[model samples]
Target: MFATAARNFVEEVDHGGWLIPVSSLNDTVNLLSVVVKRKRFWIWQRPKYLPTDFHLNDILTGDTPIQPVSIETDFIKYDGTYGENMKGSVNANVFDHSSFNVEGKDSSKLQSSFGSLKKEELDVQKLLRDSKNRLLDMSHGLVQQTMEKHRQVFGIVKERIVTTQPCSVIEEVQQGGNCGGRLSFCGGKSPKVSLKENGSLRKDSDVTMEIPIHTTIAYALIELEIKHDGRFELCLLSDTKGGFEVDGPASNQLLGASRAPMSPSESSHLKEELEQLGEHFQVLSALPATTRASLLQHITKVMENKEAVSSLQQVLEQMCQGKRPVLEEVTATESHKKSIQAVLDLLEQCGQTESAQANQSTAVLAALHLITSAIDEMTHECYAVFWMCCSFTGLQTLKKLVHCVSENGELPLSSSGLATPTEDVYEKTEHLFASCQVSLKRDGDTVKTEIHQQPGHRPLVLCIAIKGLASLDQSD
Candidate 1:
């Protein structure tokens, strides 16, 4: 009974220690079968569990026979009856008659010298340092060459026209002059040589004409291409008082008084606009990946327009009535929400201001304000929605769902595999039609999931279901 208990304990420990994958267990068994070859043998005398007097004396004499070590001895007895010649093998270290050292010992002096050697004693450090320096030099040269090549490939931009305002213009007309009063003495001297004008010319009336002239301003426009780094080589395109008329205020003279220093308020507004544009560019450049994206979308619907608000109210009204809002129906209606249509119409109206006839400065400013307001409103609404979604589903669950979706793609529905490739979505969508309807409702911080059975009214209603007669409530 003691031996049986010991064996059971040993088996339990061994079983706990050895772990194998289920698929590979059969492979391990097959290998063991070939190695051991099924056989039966009688049990030999059991070895002493503790060291005995013989073991102590054997250590003193160092000439006692050692017990053989076998893999089979670990758990079960092995009989070599199937083999013709059966010889027991013992671990070489088990015997004490032979020399213990596998290889001869090294000289003490050599070992001591090896231990004393410093980093300077080896050439490896120097070789590594030299190699690194060479690598750095090569890298520097390559970078320089690359920069030079780029400089040569892309030519400088030159300006073709120069505009300037001229100072002034003069217009004159000529007519024959009539001899008037000369000095008294000159009149006497000229009396002998003076010629009289013809009668036709004497009686002719004087003709005069006025001509229009233009004056050029003092400002001159100098156009040049510049680098993004703010380091620029000025290439003279043209010098003029007035810059390109096509560029509006932006193309005015750089040195002239056209671009006067802006007021502090103007500067602040411009900076804010630039910063907002940069932020928008960054957001758009990055991929949209967030667990709250759906919630954000819902919030956007709530905050978008008065129409969206009305729609949400209608949903709430219907839900109050005897109606179960079918998630599918809600999702379909969300796709066609009049609030979304309002946003689309707003965008269309904004686009109309871009027509050639609508190129006034006021129109441009209005368009800009409209776009900025829309974006700001949308972002705030979306964020509100995200929090609402978080309130409905605990933050932790939402985070886990996000990570799972990111790593595992879609959730594993009853029949779905670990991951369904998007390419196969159209084919597999039919199989995934059983999602929880409760997960798709739109309510403030809560989604009502209690099943409702009502036969007369519409089959499903949103949170606030408003039916035929009740729709009149909207008019009120």
Candidate 2:
């Protein structure tokens, strides 16, 4: 019989989809078959109770022990016959989760030299810094695109397009794919047909089919909720997120100014529209290439034509919605831990406006300032997230070194691997921990050791990497 082994079945939250794809599901089943060969015990479905961001690919490497999450992913022992090997496989860590201690784990290490090394608190802080920059860039990009769309909408100003005030009701594309209530006539015009010499329709008169009928919309509104302290959230008003409410007076005004009244729908001959269409056309020869778009928050509200953006009232009824997705957390690496205080500080600082503007109900100007100054005061305090306790390699090294020194009492300098390849490396970071020579001197109670860099005969990255790893690791 084969082992009842299966990689964790993580929930698919990286994308917004109704369900996981068939291809991905099939691949998972195939992979399970390959891993669990004969299958001693049975697992109903893949285990889905793991961490949201727990990626199995991050761990798998040759000869790495298959330690299961004791009660969670642990397979039941068929009998004591499978023996100690199978029993050891089910145990999670060198330090088990239930108890804070491990059987043969030691807790003593010299006080770590925490001078400048502590300031370089791992890659996560760097990742967070990059995220902050990306968000600000998105805001700037969205603003530019919205302004361009605003310019095009303004082009038809002279045609008396403001026929009615906007209803402010949420709507979508209608049955005929017409974007209801949208004022920009910039995309997909009415379909045209080609005619032949005898004034008859051409056989392939669908030449104008490619002309898009969908209205090209832009991101017009953003709701940035700046909560008490530094709890802040920013949402773009888009069709996918169902848009934000336009209830606040100032925010509501911003929404209304960005729209204009739509012409009432009528059933009339094509020639009937030709006369007024020409008049409207003459007015729009150039708003596309002129002035900078000012705040569109004061579009004239006309009441005479009182037919607000049609009676479409469309709603996407996704009553049985998919499960809510989770945000990926910035987890700590083995070398360093995150300071909760730093995250709180970011929430308080980056999540809020600087000063007086924070008190104002509609302080868009102040919120803009927060984006720049959010990561200003970064605390350089971090601890071991994977808890700097005894690891398998550490324990093995301690035992081996003790045994070596017990006889010789000292070794000048030698390769640490004991005439072998690096079998004890963390599979995820095997490449990062390059070759090194370690010298141990047994003086008093402690065996003083120094790890010296050894550039073996290999390609320098396919040349340079220890430098990169030093940059990556928070520990000096």
Candidate 3:
């Protein structure tokens, strides 16, 4: 191809296709372009070694130097006719004869540099592996923290559920022998039993159960919330924690102050009566004054309104089917009488007035009696919250209170004749309550839970909020 191009260039010099002036025979002639046969193209007589795809021999891409070599070129021309042809050969330099062996000719210095590059690549891989291992350790710590929080929360929930369950099984077994009516909420139907001459049941018997429930403190608060557009404000606390390990070392250090022993003045009330009840008193005392005051105010408001309470008390008397037997009246000052009366009023407000009316009232009645008895006792004696809850109010005591209320109504006289205030005897009574050791704050759609873990106190805070799309849907 090179020979043909050079021959054509010589033939076209007359037409001024490529012209150059040479002063001597040694002067160089350069051809920038040439025509070979019917095609025209630019050509370079020099050898070139451009970078290749590096896939060759698995070597990296680099500047490769190629050396040109000499080759024999043949030229043909017609002298006068086609039968007489003349041919000549000459030595020419071309790209066809060139050497490309970069690896073999490289200096020792270049080879050493390549070795250093390979060492750097290995070092980079080691760094990545170590970083991955460190990340794995951190991930395990995070997973443990998340799991511990869930376990603590669930432990609290499980405990509350168990403590709140009623001892209805024993009551059911005892009532089995007697034909007396028993209420079971587990099913839709009530068990049929032969009654022994009980009083007539009113057409509004269901409403009898309804009134007691409606008049309760819980029910009253729910109503006030709906009517006044109030918020769901509730707080439950425990000074005694359940058995569960906390999260981490840093968390422990941060929470060290919370684990300090309670102050003498703070826990002084518990010293008087160190039982389960003291737990409540501790929590009650820890609560903010505003919260405690608001709670007391609501309670007092419920007790003062006796209309609903009176109606439910009558329901209990009817359910009992006649005045119960009276027992020896316990002596009391007018002030003491009034205090007990207020306590009774509070009980009635909590639907305890009808505890004797139904058997299914276990959950309600058990909690009601526990609180009522604790309140009355705490006024005169110091009992631990634990013992207060564990020991039930004597069955005889319930009958005695019921009988007195039934015979002459509230503030009934003793068998010897005692004068008691009937109405307008309410006085301000400041009781104690406490707070939990958890912090909660709202941030748009999320509630961040933070707990300062205290010794013997496992604090749990629950925040329920409808946010974002949920709020929009609820609006409708």
TM-score, predicted candidate 2 vs. hidden true structure: 0.14
Model 1, 263-303: lDDT tens digits are: 11222332343343343222212212231232233434443
RMSD of 1: 47.9
Best-fitting candidate, measured by TM-score?
A: 3
Please identify model 1 stretches exceeding 4 Å from their true place: 1-337, 342-476
Q: Write the per-residue lDDT of candidate 2 for residues 1-476, one digit (tens) a residue.
A: 00000100001111211112111111222110111111101011111111112122222223333222211121111111110000011122222212121121111111111111000111323322322312212233332343233111100000000101111111111111111111122226755432222111111111111111111100011223222122223332322211112335544222212222121122122123233333322222211211101100000010000110000000000101222212122221111112222222322332254442342312211221221111111111100101111123232333344233223334322445542224333331122222212244434333443323332211121111121111112121
Whole-model Cα lDDT of every candidate shown, in order: 0.23, 0.19, 0.21
lDDT of 3 by residue, 355-459 (tens): 334432332223323232222222111112211211232222222222222233232334324333122211100001112222333233322323333312111
Alpha-carbon RMSD, candidate 2: 37.0
lDDT of 3: 0.21
Best candidate (score: lDDT): 1
All candidates' TM-scores?
A: 0.13, 0.14, 0.16
Estimate candidate 1's alpha-carbon lDDT, on a 0 to 1 scale. 0.23
